[model samples]
Target: MTSPSSPSSSSDAEIVVVDLFAGAGGLSTGIAQACEALGGTLGEDVRLVAINHSEDAIATHEQNHPWAEHYHAKIEELHPPDVVDPGAVTLLAGGPSCTHHSNARGGKPIREQERASAWHVLHWIQQLRPEQLLIENVPEFRSWSRVIDGEATNDGAIYQQWIQTLQALGYTIIRDDRGRYGVTLRACDYGDPTSRRRLFVIGSRTHKPTAPEPTHSADPEDDLREYRTAATIIDWSDRGESIWARSRPLAKNTMQRIAEGIRRHCDDRLAPYADVVETLGPEDVEQLQDDVVPIDDLETAVKERTEPFLVTGEVAIADGGVTGEEPDPGAVLVMGQHSGAYPRDAQGRPVPTVTTTGAIHHIAVDAFVKPRNLPQRGVHSNATYDPGAQPAHTITARNHDGHLVSPYLIVYNGQSDAADVDEPLPTVRTKARHALIEPDLFPWGLDIRYRLLEPHETKQAQGFPADYEICGDTKRSVRKQIGNAVPVNLARALGAHILSWNTPSLSTFGGGVTADPETEIPAYAEVSSTDD
Candidate 1:
């Protein structure tokens, strides 16, 4: 076992980091950026050791961060001493597998079951009590409770216990205005293209930690930078092929959606075969316009503001453009043919173009939820626990129904079906659910093209640079690594806040304070022992 050598010289100013469950180096990249932002050189002043069990993930992390040492073993399998000396680690960071606790949209599991949870992290923390530590997970993780007698005693009972234990171990957790133990942040607020909401629990042994302030805003009135758009990260060079020249013809339902998209989104609004217009600035107009020579109707030709609209159809175009197409069924936007939405090649790389029109804002499926007041005797969930309400349902002997689900998240609520190219992306998922909608901006007769958002695109959206390489044997694996990452910009913001605290009340070598004297436990806190 070759462990990283301990601190060559005992410089309290140096930063040593060990990233547990470091998926594709997102947090590591951000932390390194934060360190460099503080004027330190990599490998000399700041060193990193990344840990993960996934082969491809560790390979990806090693590819990007060559300066850092890596341990390709599960968190529970590796001994802390064999990985690195506890005394040398200044910062310990992790994003333990959230597959079990995260909402449906949040912790979509990778095929290879990765079951390490906060317990593994807690065990490791007990072994390597670094001066500062931060944990990242889906916001719903705040509700995780320990299972006792096959039932949860209370919501967040486990999390509260974890925090109190850390506090007892001489750490000060960051708190927000609402007295929440951690800061909850949106990725896009820090200029990341994806609007993923995540919870970050930051604790420091030295000084009080501050939450990073938002640097971008949805509101234009704020002095911060405007949120970035999906169009910004895309490689426009691959505009896709002409709609008429596909190897396989477009599907009937898909063509129908395309026609509707044309009617509602384009038709009178766009010049099918004209010069592409320059993207408009906010100061530009009531609706974004095209200055090209449609030569006929300048009024009808301008695109109706942001994002590409329903593109085209040979049937509709041949029929002289929308002969009363059912008042346009809200622009037929269906998901892709594959289970995860991406079409792969002989080797699993996501193809840039496909035969179909792909997913667009031109169509919508009527979303439905089971009526809350169906005049029913049926139980909404097993956790609701009126066994009488659902007498016919299987009653498990364990009775740990609350552990079965977390009925939380805004999967479709408050979010658009498809975001405009000019707007921030919807939350990136573990699967390739996000698809591209490319409009035939000019007279190429291509109409609009669709493809799953490429891995590189999603990576850049997470604030990783274009050169960052993601390794995987298959397409799903590659996408999972990218989707599961902490947004680099958001992590950088958090890292900056922690690294900037220069003066430690006591040496990290000798711990002093244990949490804030004024720190308030969260309202959901049930600070009780496991045996209680």
Candidate 2:
């Protein structure tokens, strides 16, 4: 075992990263970016070498990150693990194949073939022994080692076995004593407009005794922390406004409803579509216009918008040319430069946290509950926003496709610059944005009524470069990629804390802080003896 003591002269040269189970390279990208943020020279000598069991995933990784050497075979296939030079590896990071530990698999016995294949990561870790290790997974993994009271411990039983193996290899352990890690995280915590939370574990063979600190918190009493909400990261379209930025796609049913609502509200004032034309700054409105073409008439435009929002399959919007009444829904609609709307629940606040389970159908704007009944009341979250602060929580893909399900965001509610209570939602500033919404009014009645997030838009919400691709065209593949990965920004901030030479203070919403310092307990805190 190595301690984080004085480094050899060679240590300053470079640091190599080996990404095992490198699904679409989200973790690797985050670590690489975080290293860059550390403010030092990094190059080929200290770079990423990613490996994954899926050939398609490897290809996807290759497409985006040509610098990294990718291995398409399973980790166990490494004859002496020939993926990369063993001695050059500085860190090993990834969340392994989570099927066995996932709740979705449900009490069914895992396929022996897949189970056998999954163990290869442990084999690789044992063989490589990189200086540092980072692992991420759902919270239930804490008990994957054993079936509790014969209830069938799919998550706990397997995790216990995995950790035991690591423990045997002389790795230290750190888990959330209160088990809060797996909850959603809003992206605004790290200067992002969305809120996304993830469960992370960082261990090192050579680094000092340190772990990642909470860069964001839901508590309010703590100083130096700001509450990040949907109002913070306005949609790239709504930049400069105070709302969580969003570019998420809405579900078909929800899209229909939204278009109907907007149309109804603006009906009497509905002018010719051309009359409201606006340009997206100096840039040719062509780019934004091409996303959705507006019809000359209002009813036609509603139908055009509904086609993409409601249909699960792709519907190409042709040339985005001005079409007459009774036009094809497949025709593309052009959108002029305009501020985007806030994804809200029935009461007109931001939507609640979305999950891959119903990826598309649950799109409702969630809001931090504030009583219109009493203006003096504090913020309230209906299973969304922080209980104490004003910002969103965190945004993550939380799906296998690497598509963003729910952007952990705070619902921003306030008087507009016009001092009007009912002003337009703030525009976002980030490049490439999409909004999420419920598929239809009766989603629970039919599971088939699901929402589909555009692949590119999903990547943007998860903090991937705008052009990044997940390497699969199928829904199952895409959703899986999004669900399996970590929130890159969240990981980056946490990594900074773990890698920092000094302790970092919390920065998200200070809603997690306890009012009584001596109490050592907060309202939402769930203290446990097993935190070590």
TM-scores for all predictions: 0.63, 0.52
lDDT of 1 by residue, 223-283 (tens): 9887776556655444333333334433332333333223322333232211122121222
Q: What is the C-alpha RMSD of each candidate to the true structure, in Å?
A: 15.7, 16.0
Off by over 4 Å in 2: 1-13, 40-42, 104-118, 146-151, 154-158, 178-196, 207-209, 217-452, 469-479, 500-532
Candidate 2 displacement at residue 141 in angstroms: 1.2
**Residue-level lDDT for 307 in candidate 2:** 23
Top candidate (lDDT): 1
Q: Rate the local accuracy (lDDT) of all candidates.
A: 0.52, 0.39
Worst 10 residues of 1 by lDDT: 404-413
* Per-residue lDDT of candidate 2, residues 390-476 (tens digit): 432222233211111111211122110110001111111111122321111111111111112244534544556766777786745
Cα deviation in Å at residue 74, candidate 2? 1.7
